[model samples]
Target: MDTASRTAIVTGGSRGIGRAVAVRLAAAGQDVAVVYSSNAKEADAAVGEIEAAGARGIALQADVADEDTIAGAFDTVEQRLGPIDVVVNAAGIMALQPIRELDLAQLDRQLRTNVRGTFVTAKEAARRIRPGGAFVAFSTSVTRLHLPAYGAYAATKGAVEALIPILAKEMGDRDVTVNAVAPGPTATELFFEGKSQQVIDRIAGLSPMNRLGTPEDVAELVAFLAGPGRWINGQIVFANGGAA
Candidate 1:
């Protein structure tokens, strides 16, 4: 995969799996634009790492759910790095609450940030991505596993997975690919926060690997989808370590 002259935009690139994807793309010789919602410091750190990997890197701030913000972020990337060739929509939030206890506000937040954000980001990519480009969206294994508290979060990811096939069809004529990456229990801050050691162990044990997944593990798959795995489109690739 000769990505040396290509450019990629990774939303939520300031931390976790998003950060890992951004860095891995950079290491693969793609100029990277790291988009963050609020954390400039973390975004800058990601940019630094991308640059150290011998690729051009820039950090842009934008709320992924807002249409105007997403547009502005894409504009900045185009202006700074040229036409975007790859997009990884990794900006999302997880609000774990039973359906009965889920509030309208929390439900709206999850839908807006996760589902709407993925929609808006993919729309922009569909509009601007060059031929042979790819768009990757994030889903979660919880959508299939159906845990008790993850109703809302899983709903949002389910929406993402549903959109993949349609988006792939829409973008196919342009020689662009659309896909989703569903990760299982990973050792991200979002996954480990507020959990006891026993809880973490139990979660890890859910996977046949008997261990929590690493960001790099997920990122490697994302990198492959963005580069060599372009032929695999409109599908949800689960990097779950055989969990579920």
Candidate 2:
């Protein structure tokens, strides 16, 4: 799709990679709706960045995991910015605990916000996005890395990856594309918090690039998928610096 013709809704766009993706889409001349569950200040800041890029920007708050909230959020976006030509499902949660110690509550939370959330968001996108639009879902390299305590989290992302192909086929008649981007260890606030310097260094060393991925790095890949990368559909593009 032409950048100028794009109108996108990015879930969890208030901060980190989601915010960066929103900014990048705006830079590419796509009007953006930045959706957030909370943190009005951050969402407003993201809107400012998008507007600075000379694209229409709006902030809408909703829980992507909730069907009603997701519907309401998309309605607001469509009302404010024309039909969405791009939908980026970047909203997710990560909680780590060994399988033996993993509680039902944590598992439910991850499934609701990660797997089910992606499903709800993409289902809505499938129904609402313009015929030639694109849908991008977020996955994680932890799935490939097979970390000890990340089984549950990885399962959620794995489910997302599994759904992309089916979604692509379902949306094929409309010429829409579906894909997922699996990022490695990114330097988002979520990754940095409670980590010691040594731990961070070790995590960085795990990647062949010898550094953690940045939000902008992933955003660049997302921009490609949203625009020129349309031909690449139903695939998991790992933006992990060759880690796993």
Candidate 3:
């Protein structure tokens, strides 16, 4: 892939880190395709942001968990934007629950979206992304924090993190770097949902910075991995503010 005309596909680009990544990549000179599952309004707005950054942007709807739909979305993107150089699978869901009180249905949903969705997207990226491209998947810092009520969500992301190294090695011959970004508590709508201010403060205090991460914070790291951080592959990068 030529650096001058690289194109990127970002799943879950309707909001949060994924949206920030799409805008950032666009600002960095990549034509970006925002793959959204629902909410066409938000997806269209994201494309507006991308265009404002002076790059071509398109919105495509596809469930990341469905292989056929996602594969078609990939084909559409390449057909419209030329070959893809970056694939970011940031589409996911979270439902906090203790193991003893786990809801099987919720667990299944998370597994389908977080685990299977990533696999489907990664498979497409492996097949289509050009040489010197990148594939970034999302994990969570909760997998290491081992927090209560995050068992199911963390488990799904753990499975995602497990795919990074092996996939990177497999893509080595193609010169496509594969990695996962594990973000700490972030100040997105998703993170704030169902959480009280007091609880949010305590979680923020866990980081040395004493604040939750912004979508842009994680986006910056992802942009690096997708762009010039090619040497750093097959690893789970923790994008927390010294929250260990």
Candidate 4:
């Protein structure tokens, strides 16, 4: 792919890692559809940033876990900007709860958003993304660290890890690559939500880099995989600064 004017659908594109990916893709000359669950304002803001980067951008609403909504979101993007060349499934939620204290409600929500959401988003992308396209799914380094309070959250990302290779094989002849990016503790709101400064510092120290990741750190790899890294399929690339 030459990377010029390619269209992409980035789920959860309103903030954090998703927003960073959107900005990177746009700066790379790709039109982006910034999909969000409920925050139209944030989505619009992301699109604004995308347009400023010299590519067309649109805001769309879709619960990533819902098949119909995802399908519609893809359709809208293709209709408005043209065929989608990349699909980035970055919409997910994480809550810290050990196995002993895990709440069924939280477990169900995480399963729906992280596991089912990726499956549905990948399914739609498989059906619609143009030839020589790519799909970048998100995972986490915690899946390897076996963090205690991340049982349910890790389980959801584990399911994503299992799908990457299978989806790549299925898309073999189609020329679309499938892969997952597992990030370590990042400085995103999602990572800082409930943690104190001491806890954050402790987690950051676990990585050899002795620092937390930023959205741009993860986005760099995403831009590579979605752009020129077609040979890197069916693998989980850890963008965690060697944290795990």
Candidate 5:
């Protein structure tokens, strides 16, 4: 293996935005490991796409919120691929309900998978990523949109956004950049679930482009940060087509 070859691990990479980012990094000549919570079949498909992109690929199963599990997965990735160059914490869960109507359990699920997951993944990335590498976390435009019924979900990502700059400053000495990508109204399986066409259309129209963001659209920004956008650390970048 070429020691200089970049390697990336993308959580929630079995499908949706995470899958897109993994494939995008592979296309940019980086070996990739797609870490998924479950769904071996989807994970394998993502790896196949990564391989087809002319780069090495593998799939690992691990919970993003579990520190030991993710740490072990990172070890396996380095053993199989190389020292990590990038870690994208694309794994998260969202539940939208008015604050009054929101279930406490739903909020806990979001916090566990979104906040704790990012922290765990980011922790490993901080320690394991090579100098000049990058750590990217996912946020949402809802933080700025302040949409009704998104209180809990938005709050979780807000916490993620708050941590990005602090983590970036902490990693400054190591020459590793840390940032978060805040996508708006992305058209993914998660976004479509429980949303009616009317709701979807209204949200899509919020963008100046009058369309929902595609997973690849957000992946493009992630790919940039993962590779050449080194100066862009410590920011909650909104990739929402002028939305909010």
Candidate 6:
């Protein structure tokens, strides 16, 4: 992939899959800018790990749901890291409950962070990312599986998948690829919250592989799309360990 000197920005890089991707991209030889909405400590830690991976890295703060903030983040990355060749939008929130018991407030929050946040960042990437660049949006395999309580969250991701192809087309022979990664039952803190061991085991068993996925597992896919998987564009690659 020859990503040496290429640059990337990974939102939500403070923790979870985003953290893994930031470090992995650095390992692949791309300068990295780690973006966090808050949590300066974790953000710094992620950047530290990136530097440990032998790439120059910096940490920036931006609310992914805010257009101005996210745009400012892009500008900062460009000014500091060089022109961005890859953008991974991994900042998101998830709260599960049956549709009948859904919390309207949570739904609003999810839509803001998951859907609108992705849109704001993606809009910037579409305009700014260099030709032959890649934009990776995080979705959920639950959207296709249609799990019981994921209605609102799934709807927001469905919107993400819907927008990807259009954005890829908009790039229009520019050699940039816009796509989404739909992960199922990853072992991140966010995914583990509020779930009992019994429930977790059942979900893990749903995968033909008989276990949950790791953040690094998903990051490998993101790194490929970011660097080597240029022809695999305008699609969602599900990294669920054969689950769902």
* Worst 10-residue lDDT window, candidate 2: 1-10
Q: Could you tell me every candidate's TM-score relative to the true structure?
A: 0.98, 0.97, 0.98, 0.98, 0.97, 0.98
Ranking by lDDT: 3, 4, 5, 1, 2, 6
TM-score of 2: 0.97
Report the lDDT tens digits of candidate 1 across residue range 1-244.
6888999999999999999999999999999999998999999999999999999999999989889989999999999999999999999988777789888798899899999999999889999999998999999999888878889899889999999999999999998989899999989999987779998898899898899999999999999999988789999999999886
Which regions in candidate 4 have their CA more than 4 angstroms from the true location? none
Cα lDDT for residue 91, candidate 3: 99
Root-mean-square deviation per candidate: 0.9, 1.0, 1.1, 0.8, 1.8, 0.9
Over the stretch 26-100, how does candidate 6's per-residue lDDT look in tens digits?
Answer: 999999999998899999999899999999999999999999988898998999889989999999988888999
Residues 147-182 of candidate 2: C-alpha lDDT, one tens digit per residue: 777889999999998999999999999989899999
lDDT of 5: 0.93
Better of 4 and 5 by lDDT: 4
State in Å the error of residue 80, model 3: 0.7
Q: Evaluate all candidate structures by whole-model CA lDDT and list the values in order.
A: 0.93, 0.92, 0.94, 0.94, 0.93, 0.92
Q: How many residue pairs clash in each candidate at the backbone level?
A: 0, 0, 0, 0, 0, 0
TM-score: model 3 vs. ground truth: 0.98
Model 5 RMSD, rounded to 1 decimal: 1.8
Q: What is residue 108's positional error in candidate 5, in angstroms?
A: 0.6
What would the per-residue lDDT of candidate 3 be over residues 79-110, giving only the tens digit for each residue?
A: 99999999999999999878999999999999
In model 1, pairs of residues that clash are none
lDDT (C-alpha) at residue 174 in model 3: 99
